[model samples]
Target chain A: MTESVITVEHGAVAYDDRPVLRDVSVRITPGEVVAVLGANGSGKSTLVRAILGLVPLNAGRVTLFGTPQRRFRQWWRIGYVPQRLGAGSGVPATVAEVVASGRLARRGVLRPAGGADRRAVAEALQAVGLTERAGDPVVTLSGGQQQRTLIARALAGQPELLVLDEPTAGVDSASQDAFAEALRGFVAGGRTVLLVAHELGPLAPLITRAVVVHEGTIAHDGAVPEPAGHHATPGHEHVHPHAPDESSGLWGS
Target chain B: MSLFQYDFMIRALVGALVIGLTAPALGIYLVQRRMSLIGDGVGHIALTGVGIGLLLDRSPVLMAVLVSAVAAVAIELIRERGRTPGDVALALMFYGGIAGGVMLVGLSGSRSNANLMAYLFGSLTTTSPQDLTVIVVLAVLVLGTMLVLRPALFAISHDEEYARVSGLPVRALNLLLAVTTAVTVTISMRAVGLLLVSALMVVPVATAQLFSRGFLATMLAAMGIGLVAAGSGVWLAGTIDTALGATIVILAIGIFLVVAVGAAARRALVRRRAVPAGTAAAVEPCDVVLEPAPTSPTPALDLDGPDHAAVPR
Candidate 1:
């Protein structure tokens, strides 16, 4: 009977009259680690974006903690780590500075950063095992390190629910292990997590449930789907039948 | 000391000092967002405001602020819509602005091209007490807003989508940034001139970036660079009898080049010292030499074979 952390009922989304997600319904309760899985272009990203109100939904509704997405103002309660991309903009920002920005939601615009904010930033950096590189420019970090910095930024907010899109898509194995460790710590705190990923590698064991998005709708909403046959082997090459075959000739097989 | 004796010189220096502090304060965010030339675009539009004021016999600074604010809002709306690429839209505004300013100035019968030139190239020597007052007020406003909202501004400028999701008012802040940029353009028009204002806004930050590793450091260094450039540019202009705006901008650019070259040379020196050590370590333990065995004959497969010769002959 407790309120769900995230709720989407018949959610639909379109870009330029082209539908990306349709008839997508999902509900995530507190303390659940849910992974939205699908091949590329399956609209898994769009679904999460819609839930975060990053993208407009064409139809249906989304609610965070039972409050409608539009009216929901308690953003400090939710931390979002967007799809992994370069953390640095044109301007140079250190890892700690970037992570400290996450505290803006908790610390209003006018007030200065208090001791609590600094502590949160420090803790977030330590959680991601990036305390050593906290002073380095984000651009100087490796791709995986930058991704960790982003996760650290999200964690700095100390939110109850964390939403991430592909936290380990192109990360190195070491950073992936660090990320998985961080997620384990986050889950141990009895928080909730929802992420969009193509293939959960290190994160596979952390996911309690999986919601498979196929062509914009939920294909499966149950226990994590086990890899079949060869895919079950450790270090086996992960393949998606629905993904475009890059090895096929340019004209396609 | 002698330079500070004259009232006009004192006003000019004071005006430059304010411009020094404010231009780069606002410029850092603009640079972060990759909108370095936004100041120039707003400046051009403000020129049209300057023209309107000349025609109406009202305060040119006030008119410039009003007009540029509207233009800035329009530009922000266009950017938000993303229908037109931001640079293309800005180019259009730039041309439209300068064109409108020229035409309006011509229509204003009493005002001559010389009067407009003062705003164009900046005649800091002629900075009246009233102009100084306006500059200080606007500078305070710009600095105050930047100080108060820096974190939010930095958040949006760094990653707009993340900021939006974080419940920061991205749209409103963007508009405020545009307006703030407009105010900066007008405030700087009397000291650096409208046309070259962007140089002052951009170059100092560019110089600061060479040595600074973080946003706050860059911003602080840029402000310091700007202060030095502005203060010294005025004194140098007075001493050399050069155009104030050009002198200030050139000074800023000069500082940027020095720092850039210094940073590059320092990096090269570090690499030079580290390279030999790294190569020596790599060579000491991993060196492997292989000799071709006497039993391996036919040159490891015959490069002159018919199969190889037939491929492209």
Candidate 2:
């Protein structure tokens, strides 16, 4: 069997002593596209946080490529795109400045970004279909463009693994389509991806496997059986009418 | 030439430069974090410390620095302990510090209320060589910390969680910011006085941000702007014979507004020009097709789409 790129054994997480994720065990092999699904506050983001060492595991071990979460190294090999990238977060940084930040791990301190860094940044932007908007103020971009910029930031790292928490959350339908297309390209390039999402219906077809997180435990983990009645074949698109909208509620229409 | 040649004028210029460079260097982080009031809080806390030292016949500035540093740590610890935001904690500590210093001064009943006024309001004309030396050393230390902590600063600035995920020492960096703020505040107190020091720290960085992109350039621009404001403010104070710190801060604000408006106009002009050059550099030629293999590696998971056919694992 292929060695697991991420190993979580009986992991538990909490905030202020109230448990969020508990005794959860999961193993993700290298190159697998895993989707973590759950309702609101199902501890999905918390689990991702635990795996990335952003949240302390109360009871179990989280190892990324054999290294324990606390000791996880090769930072340049991992990239993250959060749910929201606020443009005016007081940093007053432009899109390029924000994207260049993805190179911090590789650049270390005081060492300036060189020629290769610029190329990677450009390519990442191009991959996200954001080459035209590269110089725009991150704050000035529409919601979709900002999200794409965030994804480009992760891609700039050229990470072996990319973790996204709700990549399409709060994004427009068209932007979501574009984001999905870009992600498909990423996986095609031999990289791995793990994502935590609220509504899995719209993105179900693209997911290789679904791990349902309920009450901090894996409620379901298996290859997603083709959704009952939806047949996705060559030259056909899977349509889920519940395209998420701001007022349509979290689960969607 | 005489302004540069005179001893007192030289001291004022050098003093302004040192404080200008140091306060805003630390202020960049403060402004980014929405902790602009920290300089004010630290200054007040340092005053209480200085009062304590004066009561004990010690170097007031030294006492102030030590006290403020400890207070900075305390503020951080408090912030971490409770769920209160950093700015809220800073305001509380700021008021608490001012009250404590006032009480201490009332109890001690020291001579020369005017001297206290001078320190509180800033008087660059009285800077001693020793004061300049201390400011220089402290400025170097602050700059050194800024350089060493650039990554952490960037992390804290954007996507703090991702920064933590990337294995940045976040807590350590936070503490470093606290200490640096305290030190910078203490040094700036002599130049702008305790009350107006925060204005000096915040205005330069804010003004610099008008024209710059990227973190390093912003800081450089902030330092350059700060120097101009400080020098100009000191000269204005000399001409008008008003409070030096107040003059400096007002001048800094004026400069900030002018730069901000000009920069905004320039950006609008550029955007208008780019309307026609839309195809020039906006979009690249290589983005025609974007399709990666389904059988890619593990870490390349895309959060979008239903194309998960690759990866035998």
In order, the B-chain TM-scores come to: 0.88, 0.81
TM-score of the candidate numbered 1?
0.90
Q: Per-residue lDDT tens digits of candidate 1, residues B1-313?
A: 6877999999999999999988999999999988898899899999999889989999989999999999999998987887558768888898999899888888897557888898888988898898899889989999999978988999999998888888988999999999999999998999989999999899999988777777888888889999999999999998988999999999999999998887766556555664555554555445321133122222222221111111111
lDDT of 2: 0.75
- For model 1 chain B, the run of ten residues with the poorest summed lDDT: B304-313
Cα lDDT computed for each candidate against the true fold: 0.86, 0.75
Candidate 2 segments whose C-alpha is farther than 4 A from its true place: A16-18, A86-88, A200-206, A225-253, B1-5, B85-92, B105-112, B147-151, B210-217, B259-313
- Model 2: per-residue lDDT, tens digit, A163-234? 999888777777888788888888887778899865554566668887878778887788864544123212
- Whose lDDT is greatest here? 1
Per-residue lDDT for B22 in model 2? Answer: 74
Candidate number with greatest DockQ:
1
Residue A237 lDDT in candidate 1: 42
